[model samples]
Target: MRKGKLYLIPTVIAEETQAVVIPPHILQALPGIQYFLAEDIRTARRYLSSLKVYESIEPLIFEVLNKNTKADQLKKFFEPVFQGNDLGILSESGCPGVADPGSLAVKFAHEHDIQVVPLVGPSSILLALMASGMNGQRFAFHGYLPIDGKDASAIVKTLEKESRSKNQTQIFIETPYRNNTLMAVLMKSLADDTQLCIAVDVTGKDESIRSYSVKKWKSIPVTFPKSPAIFLFLSH
Candidate 1:
């Protein structure tokens, strides 16, 4: 029997903007996917239902795949593929197999000789970089920085030093609730000449993308909201 292919499906980064951020072709392809591995089954079902490609979501199969998922559980998640059934991986937001835990599934598929196809969709990381006006030619994404006060500051300075030395853009994110904390550390740690870009709610109605020098950022009195955001910097 021919092995089924593994599709890396991308989901909307923000709610209520699915039609705007998700492409028509992605919607058209959803109807053909019956098996999915999602970080959250409820939200995954709701998102698929919103696309309105299926007559009924009850027939679709969803299995949990999150940070807590272990290597021993890979066989169970990809069982359908072994039986010649296509499988899809969905992230809680943005593209799967990125910063999300979906990479494990992708690795499993590769090991089993299952074809992997990544569909196009919104990725907050890429969108932020595109709008940042920073050096996109050479860049690195550090999923999340240390939350400790001293550690976060040290890492920020280290990344800035690396960016200056290599002329590369350094990108990172923080938990929504800790936005202000991280922002505070960034403001205090980075040199005044460093360029900083704060892209908040990309592809959302209240989207805000601002690129300014650390000096300017210090002068501005701002408090980051509890919303999904991306932070990038480049040092001279």
Candidate 2:
């Protein structure tokens, strides 16, 4: 029998210091896990430390890497798991793959015939969509846009068009620091009547969700500081 299962652990609110605190009970249970794949070593350590399970853990060995981790890194990451170890994939924020590093591992597992199990928790994308009052029946999450201003704008426009045509909810994320610039560009590119939803600091103390027409939205100050956010645009 396989010794372990692959768990897509949701960082959900783990990355937001102001959001739900990852419980020690969960971390303690994780020690029994075969391995852990985290987005960032520093943030993973912080989570362990926060749970006070850092030093007490003996069985739970973890490997730290980010979304940009390559095929080589992925192969090495699952070597032990493939050899009969259960692994847990964690994100810096919300959930793994929702916008984190774990898809490659999942794809690799499927290709290698490894059993995959997803652990339930927070997902900003879903949360935002549910609250957006838009067409949730057929929605698309575009993850994060490119850092290059032009590339990002192109993707946004394409997503906007898709949303308009399919009545889809085009969800995209941006770096916190550059969020304002992205939002500004977003409003500029989209039509004045386009509906937009701003979900920032989800599942956190400062969590907020508000939707408005593009023209109306731009009139208000959308300064949410440097916080984790997901931006959604829905078509009429």
For model 2, the stretches where C-alpha displacement exceeds 4 angstroms are: 14-29, 52-55, 73-75, 148-151
List lDDT for all candidates, in order: 0.93, 0.76
Instruction: Please give the lDDT score at residue 76 for candidate 2.
Output: 83
lDDT tens per residue, model 1, 1-236:
88888988899998799878888888877887899999999999999999889999999999999999999998998888888988999999999988999999998888888999999999999999999999999999999998799999999999999999999999999899999999999989999999999999889888899999999999999988889999999999
User: Candidate 2 lDDT, tens digit per residue, 1-236?
Assistant: 46356777666462445235444445556655757888776666566555554555454577876756787777788877767878888777767776666788888888778888776667878888889888889988876788887888788788888888888888888788988888878877888888999988887777889999999997987576688788988867
Clashes of each: 0, 1
Worst 10 residues of 1 by lDDT: 24-33
TM-score of 2: 0.84
